[model samples]
Target: MARIELSGIQKRWGKVVGVRDVDIEIADEEFVVFLGPSGCGKTTTMRMIAGLEEPTEGEVIMDGEVMNDIDARDRDVAMVFQGYALYPNMTIYENIRFPLRMREVPKGEQDALVRRAAEMTELTDYLDRKPSALSGGQRQRAALARAIVRQPQVFLMDEPLSNLDAKLRQAMRVQIKHIQRQLKVTTVYVTHDQIEAMTLADRIVIMEGGAIQQIGTPDDIYNDPANTFVAGFIGSPPMNLVEGAIDAGTFTAQGIEVTGLPAALSGNVVLGFRPEDCTVGGNTPHLKGSVFGVEPTGDLTYLTIKVGGQQIEVKADRAFRAELDTEITVTFDPARICLFDAKSGERLR
Candidate 1:
């Protein structure tokens, strides 16, 4: 196993900067995921680490050795592309054994290795079948098995499940995590899907246009995002951000007022609270609003309320039966609120 470090890494194409000044340290045997929206530099960053793309600046280090000018084939890394990329004519056994053969492993050792990988990936029964005969999931497993047989220091995967059907993707996610646990290979996975990142990563690197936005454990990114961009990007329904002013121990936004704010905070601020943090009417509503809509996702519902002309979404337990077009008073726990600078979008407290 090897720890991977990227320091001040950057990539550019002519005048277009693909990734800029990114620094990340991935511990040995850790599964780190690069997550972001499409074209947000996730794939480019993964490729740079895999040596598929050279950095325009900085370094890629493994086990204290700089990887600059190293070819992808000599990087001692195994990669699974999004397309599966299996050889069309090779049998499953041949596909899995191809890497070992390339390095001239003895025939007996290659057989054992291929068999073990197939069994682990549940591809033992399809060993003789060509890629064309295998199902999409099976083909994907073959790609994984190929990577596994190499026993490389790190595994780089670029949205490998993007081509699979929804149910298959879910199943493969679980299977892949299981395989990673058994192998314990340091892995760098890239995907736009937050659910995939949340479920598969030991830590997540959230990125935006050409730069690292935040890097944290799943819970840290989910529950305590560093800024408005991260908070708004990582959640499903997303956090509700209201443009407000802070003064005289109160927050005024969209004409609605929230009282009892800490006296230390003042000036233009953006207030953020998750849907689950806002509660329906009680003794006092920090703000008043009309219910704009109800979105039921079976297990829970989100109520979109218009407070002081600003729209906010609040989570409701599935058991609650609130109707749309109803005016409701609501309150938020002061501790749950996140304040951001209105101009910079940086978290204030």
Candidate 2:
């Protein structure tokens, strides 16, 4: 029943704009992630939805009602911040129970609700310990338990896993996704980490410089990006982009030539392809270069090559072995390539 919609939302501080014309419809129980680099206004948008910050334009609608004027506490939204925010003096159980006490949910039912939340977060055994006695992961679980105790209509998590170590962050990502599914609460999570957005979201909203670049499922964003910014930002090692010209279906750049492209395009263009999509030592190589470096990460080897003074990264088998400065030939499917306007950076078909 909690369907949140932000219509033409804009946030401004005098001459500075924090967010501009953001419009998104989040379905009930949907997990939507706001993803971008720092200072991109992802957090400001979430704050507006939470009623912590007022928008200069547009409306915040929930269940078909305007919520821009509503107080934060009355919005029935639970926020878990980057900082665990657990009270130092309170035991984990008491911290989880604080939200229930504030809402004045019948004291008779508070214990059961707290216990249920604790069990769901796997913090049942640490109930009696204070925040100081818990590990970083456990403290975060305590914060989550507090939010769950309220049974809020929406969950706003702002970089909740940023403070944890890498391994713990991965574990918490699984737990958060599981808990969201279990509760069926419409959730909006904010993070700069693409891996987190790709793993946890049903849909991701990519933002930059107070504007949304694109919004789609992870697969859609990765496989068919809307623009060059998206093509470059969405993938690990990113897509290789080379400036070139297309003439009569032949794409030609310095030290590289690709043919059989769609006949509709002509003139200067930027060609893009994923690192993993390109192969080494193919019969008909699309690109030729010398191996500048090779990085092996146990599971895969990343090879960096210099092509016409531009660096292109390629993902190779983990056992791949090559000496520096060795000549290499790389080939990729022509159909897998992407084209963009060199000037505007907009995708061409």
Candidate 3:
């Protein structure tokens, strides 16, 4: 029943601003992710919500009440940090029980809650093992178990899977999402990894330079970026952007020309298209370019093509092969193309 809201939140450090005008409404049991690069204020916003950092302005509201002056412990929020932060000397069971003990839960009920959390995290068999004896993923699970045992109104996770290996990180991501759903707690997760944000979040809040760039569902953010920053930042190989001029319903760049654009737009504009949206060896080729590089990642091959002065990445079948310097014709759907104002970087339409 926790509906969290940050109204006009601002955080500043003297003359430096950590976050600026952050406003978000997190629905009950919604898994919202704060995503961006390092120093982008995602973590800073999370800290303010947790009451670890004071907001310079605005209110933190939960359900229907203002919680700006409430103590962190009294806010009923549980936080999982980037580091496992497990106790070196304590066994898994005892570590999970620590929060319950501090809150003075009945000793008899503590055992049941600890066991339930352990089972939820698949750590029931590792209860007696000390933190030193556990693997990185196991230790992180222990940390999760501790958080779950408290049954807090909100869950705040700060890059909980960053310490694990690539394979382990993927596994932990699934577990985290599953646990969040099962608990149905209002969760605020902070991470710089775009894939993590896409997979885990019910909605994503993309940030940059202490301000939010955009907020939307995974499909909304990927398929329809609001600006150039989001277009370049949201994709794996990123959207291909070219500086060009539109005249009489045609767009012409250095070595590429696209026709049938909106005739109303005549002047400098930036054109963008996703790597996956472009096609190679199509019936109606729009551009011809020499292959610069090909990267095969087992499932798909990313082909880099050089057209005039700009380079573009095109996703192709894994078995697709092409030699460097070979000329290839590329085509894409006109409906998939995006236009942006060259000066302001805003979407043109």
The candidate maximizing TM-score is 2
Instruction: Mark the regions of model 3 whose C-alpha exceeds 4 Å error after superposition.
Output: none
Better of 1 and 3 by lDDT: 3
TM-score of each candidate?
0.95, 0.97, 0.96
What TM-score would candidate 2 get against the native?
Answer: 0.97
Q: Residues 206-277, candidate 3: write the lDDT tens digits.
A: 999999999999899999999998899888988999999999988888766789989999889999999998
C-alpha RMSD (angstroms) for model 3? 1.4
Candidate lDDT (C-alpha), each = 0.89, 0.93, 0.92
Q: Give candidate 3's whole-model lDDT.
A: 0.92
Using TM-score as the yardstick, the better of models 1 and 2 is 2
Pairs clashing within candidate 3: none
Ranking by TM-score: 2, 3, 1
Clashes of each: 0, 0, 0
lDDT, candidate 2, 170-225, per-residue tens? 99999999999999999999999999999999999999999999999999888888
